[model samples]
Target: MAYYPAEVKEAARGLYCKRYSIREISRTLGIPRRTVYHWVDAEAWGDMLSHEGVEDAAQRRLVLLITRDDKTKADLQEIDRLTSALERFQRLREREQAMRGEPCETASAKPEQQDQRGTREKRERKGGDSRSGKRRGRVIKNDVSHLTPEDFKAQLHQHYFAYQRELMQAKHYRNRQILKSRQIGATWYFAQEAFEDACTTGDDQIFLSATRAQAEVFRDYIIQIAQQKFDLELKGNPITLHTAHGPATLRFLSNNSKSAQGYHGHVYIDEFFWIRGFKELHKVATGMAAHKKWRRTLFSTPSAVTHPGYGLWNGDWYNARNKVKRQQFPGFKEMQSGILCPDNTWRKIITLEDAMAGGCDLFDLNDLKLEYGPEEFENLFMCGFVDDTNAVFLLPQLQACGADPAEWADYNPKLPRPFGNKPVWCGYDPSRSRDDASFVVIAPPEKPGGMFRVLERFKWVNKSYLWQVARIREITQRYNVQFMGIDTTGPGIGVYENVRIFYSRATSIHYSVQTKTELVLKGRELVESNRIQWDAADKEVGLAFMMIRQTTTPSGAMTYAANRSESTGHADAAFAILHGVSYEPLARPRGGCRVVIG
Candidate 1:
């Protein structure tokens, strides 16, 4: 037997817990292998290893190392490696449990107690309470007590652009109004903000978008942030988070004011300018956050000036409400710099240029300018409202065509056959040079005079004509496509020719002034009669229709045309839709008179 200091024994034990071999521990600690083995047996180290998982042992070592005052560089390196290993192990465990259809333990649960807790739950479910013959209610837990405001600032807010940070700093205001450029991440930032607020303050959070699909985007972002940043799996539709304050609910809703009524929480209304019946939706939103403690945030890209939300943004609505005491608001330039209006609303205008200056590197300015023509570029990325007065499709009429896709109980895009033997119409508008081609799947009227529902829309960029035709063929397999209309001008000729080989019902449309007029007129009738509807989230469809203005041809004849060029035809989606609906014929069929076109 050889004598060893207490420090040496402790060092050997620590190394052994870190999964070092006995021989390695001996060599590292300058001790004999026989003595290390003797200490390990005497201290019951094998029993400890049997009781603790690898993650538990690593966590124990990591905590010991972090608490030491005289840590060497090697100690810090070991800490970093152990932390990373623990994270990877946790993720792997979660994946394995998911594969086995087992529920993962909460982040706050100890590894040693997880098995015992799961077994207890199973036993409780199998045998009801011996006395009452009632099973215990299943606990729905979303433990977020470990999360601090500091954690959110470090993990999430650090990645925000300058404009996003500005929005955060203005959280004290009762109301926030933001007009931003497309794809500038306004919704993304607000999702994080609301989640953080809900987690920390236990305040209920509500998200309202133009459609349920858009509202779910916020919920998805929140779930992703919780999982990636904090190792939390937030479940349930209106996710209930168990925070230190209490349990708080996060609700996601659409612009249907009737369904949104009676909810009280912090409300975030997304894409308000594009929402139909904005005035009614605004009333519902205000009622939701009626309390002084709750906040309201409204954000969107600019839509047509005729939109009801435009009045709320430009101060006209406020002026009308306060006719006796009118207050002057800051000009557009001043608003671009962000300001608190006299009505106590914090307002800001963030254009693509402002977003770029604020550290958003997602767009090439010249490329976007060329992709969307001047009018579209101005409206979408420059925070300029559309003047739809001269357009064939006015904003009010086009807005009336917007509907919530969630209301369609018969359709599910996730299924293999979304429409399930029901007849569908598909329309394709081929791309011009450097411009995106548009395709649409529409559900025609169910009865003699019912509604036309746009089910799906796709935009293909820089794809070969063969690829486009292949995609169309795949759609035919999924849907019982009764009619397919393709424009046979420019690149469309290639697609139409190839599609005709497989789908005989494919119709070729040759574009002329008269042809376009007929297509535009039929579309107009559909819009005016409230017969055509699309997902409210598809604001681009409305913008596309707005692009078709009454124009004069080189011969001075009146014609309807978008800002068309090799680089700038933004009406592809609108034309694609018109192409599909044209199969119904320009004039409505009278009794016993069915007029169909191929």
Candidate 2:
């Protein structure tokens, strides 16, 4: 409807409010004076035009205050008087224009030379400096400063992956978690925004990185942005800068978050996923910010699914992302708004696939695939929560070999053990204190190397060594176990000697790094080949499978063990099963049948 665009019209009104002549507006806009005058008279521009006089008054008063050589209480009061008169003048000017048929009916038209003279007067009053061969009246004006917020934001995301821009512009910035691909510019974007905010506001920005080196890098970047855009040089022990509003500080700290208390400001935790003692550090850092209602943005690449960060990312926030109604955990409960606004913590996940599809060329997918294996790359850049770094078995492979619920129900420990002529093998893992001793009974396939179907399982805690031996004896006699493998570590040695005193078929398995590796490899072979099926519905057994982790030594030797969490104690149940399957029976004497160890 209007001749010029909305922003141009707003800028025109703003300049007019600053007391720019119609001719000046025309030349600036590259439009004719008649067109400018015509729009300034339109009903649509009436509200803006009336407010222009008020804005002009305020700007004049503020400029005068800034230019004064020595400002006093009386001067400040006069500035306030000018501010209060702004609204009254706007109304009076509007009414006078209505009666006179033109805005500024009594004002004289001035020459272009007068505008230049007025600017020089203000510069002189403000004690302008000429050391750089330019008047000090105007501050730094970069091309980027002219861009609108939306324009600058869009340009910032040109190199971003598909979902990255969406994530950056998300309404939620206060409490946010971003699990992203490596080198995706997420940290860079946040640092830029934080520094910009600090330059314009007096708020302090606190950044806690995984290491001192990382914090130093972020500090350098923020300082660089400030210097480039504002021509401000910020340097010191703590990285301090003086902004137009006041003194703002950007403090960078490493992973020693325990000493990060007593600061009320914007908090950013970088590389959170890999931070040592992150669970404790997160509590300390976030807890300090929580009371002050400070903004918090946590950034990191995905780590093990067992990580606490993973639980936070996948728990309540994950549910919200899927648009599902679910119960929330502590600190994750819905805000009173429940409208998914910026005040709420926003969770964002962006993987390499999303980046590649979004036109990011920083990384070649083929090259990454070769450098890091598919699983490793997926975990690192694809935002996958899989424990590819240390997992003995992938969750997917384990799922593929999962037994149906009905099959598992049939083998319930509460039900009587099934009778069969099939050769039964037992793996025993023994622990005396602070751990549970467990055993898994498995039936070999009808033919060799076919598959092992786990039929029964047993676990006990706080039992005497003799009691465990009695339990083993009962199992061997009842199931007619062909070959039994038992752990011979610590108390296990006594148990093994007692078992062999009665049962010749039993074999003692010494605990060692090599022996453990052999058993874990055998289990891995079964899982990879889909040659093992176990009850997926059994939570205890399933948890054991999940806890299995493979650690690689610097010497290239690999070791297998469970990541015993407080919730899931030692993975004796898992080792018990592996030991059972490790048993191999010797051929019976030609005329004799397979001997049962009783």
Candidate 3:
């Protein structure tokens, strides 16, 4: 089930208040019927992807500390001790104040308590951080006192702290996948490291996009911190962050076009899988490449499937700090063998095969599902893609369909009668690329009583649609004059139009045309799933019906695939007529045929 975004909840709630019908509510929400009900009640309201609720604001910050490896056990213990001591010391001081008659004491003592609780280690270790000779990856690590913004405050047996300077200048990147556990402010710190690119000695461009609206909020937090702590201002108005240089906007963009264009900077796309389409993302990446000195960063919230941005961002600056800390890395099989990866340094946490492996006694699907959502979950998790796994026209069925007739002494594509050499039923598939195709054919059996043996199964290829048409016409006559169905989704329409004009000049066969996409919808309506069956003597009729259905099968399949929740019918009328003939005898004999009501 698709979850409703929180911002749309009020609009969703207004449905009952406005007393709109479910259909009207859906129209208002611009969603499907199921989504209308999904947002109808408060429980459904909670289903909205929201982070708001009752929690101590500081408790929220507490998560920041526990998640990263900046703080140590000793530091936490000392903070606790100082806090308790400071609390008691304040009580005694307040007692002394009572003797002198002041207002009841407040947590005013918290300042000194906080001083001891928060900064006691800072003071104790102030000079200690300057101590030298702590050699780390290509750089000497300093104590907490000598930490750089890029570095986490160091915690031995934990994460490396305060190493930003060393990270940027690291000689080589270790190629590995990194998986951060929960409670590691890895996200904030990850963005912080990227933000450091913005604030460091040399300026750099950055782009950050989120899967959903709230994910965009994380970028705002990073920007706010950059402004207050690091002297970076989010630029642009109607404003997002603007760069000090030419036209690089450091703005939070939703996964849509809002975030994809007009930037020449290192991209930091967060929660990449949450966003559905990447057409815009590709456009932005290509635009960024045009800038020459660009870099890219990707942040993900570990959705059910990893997105394109994650694989691509590995090329440029990724978390060198994570590598320094020995965090696990991740990879992608979906990215076409890492073709999208950044050239400089690459990392991945898991492969598709390992992602589906059973690690413990109880196998968990989180490995597969967590990396991707349903739309991508199949490829990311299942690691296989096919047109239809359980298609009725299975390979075996298709093999049977393509099988040569036993009665034929020799195989031939030559037409036998009315459609002689011209063509009859054209099966057009526009292009079986992501877009559906228009399958078409001209003629099958020469006469009305004959079967439609396979003609050209016209697959569409653009620009050279003529190549296909030329191929079809090469065998079939140029001027026999029969009806044709051209897929027309891609070049077929233009081909059909242009061919009609050319043939009017070049040939005598007056070809009538049916635009397959338009006609197929009508065809599906006629079939209505009543079941098509015929007898031994009705072989010609049965083959004609099946041929008609095959010509229109793609449309029916697409419609049913989209509306799998509902039952639909089939297409019969589309194939009922044999061929549109140019010349016929004055009185054609009517075949023994009846439209059965049952």
Candidate 4:
């Protein structure tokens, strides 16, 4: 018992080098279990406890249980809260239905279906009182290089919704990151932050980008709302009160992501997580227009674990949350010795209904401990570091067919086909030196409900791929495949002739043979875009040809070369030279049979 400083001996002991159970040491030494184990002697403790020093004693088990990390607990609580809210809402809805004397059982139930019911004829919002949300006055400042807190608040209020205020912050010019969440108002908050910066920070430009043109179009409301609601003049360079007559110059860009590159004052990318195809994102990253003084803020709702936006936000938020966790962690030492101490005290906004079962709020904040907790924070708030998942569309939007086997075939997914009895069009993407088999198939929708159904697909190992083309004759006859398109690399006339010979059944009677290249003219005419009806599947070089179709032709025959890539034949340069035919449907028949042949 020759005394040792309180933590001096504990600091030297490490996690498992202790004597007695963690609880035993704690009770014997009048110290917490974590500290007791920290001071334990490993040489002697090894004979009694495991490497982690967790023991087999019943009392130690009861007292030494590891509590959950905070973020995890927060997520669990959120799930519970949402689930509970949904349940309560459903019950309330049913009660309202009963009051109205309607069937309250199914989604398709009608009010007139039931008669006898409850007493009250009306229903209101949840909780005791129907009032929802707390209102707070906000200030927004503009037209200055810097801002007072009051001015900033004014600017923020102009754009901040109540639910969004939690994620909103003073715009930091040095950082470029995205904010992600589950049904959170991160995007709207960032928009407000950008609007404030655009108005107040002189010479600071602001660009708020959304996933679609429709979505970005709504950002104009910020200016309208600020001017009308707040009675603020967000015009003439909210920067130097100078009379530069322009439309409240906060430019709202739609997926105009490329424009976001090489010029950065302030770029707020909304719904960033849904952006697929890293090629464009990489352009923004490397060409990030932000000058030394510019900043970028990305915001989106979380949809996938591997989204590029998800990866980025996860990184910074992870480290930040962990800092707070380490600070309170009794045994662990702090790793980051830096200027920014982590402030991980984010309180969740819960429904009053959620707290009814438990006293006050029963959100358990300890379940969030994880190696990826900081990443979760990044995903939940700031998207700074991102993953590059090679996708061209949002995963959520890219829903594959269901597991139900019957719906596999004849199931008109999406909408009705766009073709409208238009002859089926086909495009062939032959493999170059690649290992996978060349894929030649029919695609494009006719009506809104039209979707791509693989009529015939094949994998060719060698020249035998052409052997499969013979089946195209049967498929053409089977479906109404009028015209077939092929990739002929570049100006290669010789290879085109060779593939045409292989596909031509005119000599064999399998079906008519037409070089797919020649069909290009017909595809230009009939196929809306050499591109496709946007069946929305990943095409090899198919998308290139489709862009060709988008181009309006000089002859009034729509040109098929509008938004094509440099490597037109890159996917199947040789296939373009191959033979494919365009079958144009003719007018009426003689005997009233009305031949609908292609």
Backbone N/Cα/C clashes per model: 0, 2, 71, 79
Candidate 4 local lDDT, 368-469, one digit each (tens): 212112333333333222221432222322322101111122222221232223345454544333222344444434443244333334544444443545
Quick one: RMSD of model 1? 21.4
Residues 1-598 of candidate 1 have per-residue lDDT tens digits of 9776454565566567656667657765567899988998898988758887788778777755654445679888998999999999989988987898665642434433443553454445457467886767454366665577999989998899999999999999999999999999888899999999987887899999987789999999999999899777788777877665566789998777866888899999999999888898999899989999999999999999889998888889999999999999998899988899988899999999999999999999987776677887898999999998778899989989998775564466766677655789988887565636899999999886789999999988777888888999999988889999898866788888889999988998888788888889889989999999998888889999999989889999888888665545668889999999988877665753534333
What is the lDDT, from 0 to 100, of the residue 402 in candidate 1?
A: 91
TM-score of each: 0.76, 0.40, 0.28, 0.31
1-598 per-residue lDDT for model 2 (tens digits):
3456444555566556544557766765556887778777874555654554456646654643533435678767867887667657767876876796642312322333333433454454457746556655432211111223454345443555555556556624567777778877777777876765665454678888755557766788876765665444555535554433445577777666544777667888887765556667887777767754477888877656655566565564446555555655333223211224332567666677666676777887775554333444566687765554456765556645645322221122332334223367888877544345777788776565577777777766667668878888887655657778888765567778888877877778876678777777777887788888765433345435556777755687777765332323355667777787775323325453442222
> How many pairs of residues collide in model 2?
2
What range of 10 consecutive residues in model 4 has the weakest lDDT sum? 330-339
Candidates 1 and 4, the one with greater lDDT:
1
Give the runs in model 4 whose Cα sits over 4 Å from its true position: 1-166, 176-179, 206-215, 232-249, 256-258, 315-598
Q: lDDT per prediction?
A: 0.83, 0.61, 0.36, 0.37
What are the RMSDs of all candidates, in order? 21.4, 30.2, 25.7, 29.9
Candidate 1 TM-score to native: 0.76
What's the residue-level lDDT of 228 in candidate 1?
Answer: 94
Tens digits of per-residue lDDT, candidate 3, 1-598, equal 7765443444455433323346655764566877666556535543332453322222332332322234578647644655566566668777986897642323223333423322333444334334563322211111112224443223211232322222233312322123222222334554655554443312334444432333445566666655555433453321322222111234444444543455555555553433345446656654664554555444333322123333344432245434454432234443422222334443333223342231212234563243222323443334322232232222112212222121121122332322223344433333322222223333334454444443323323232566655654652443243444343333336445655653432212211223232233333322233211111111122222323222224444422121101121111112222111112221236762322110
Top TM-score: which candidate number?
1
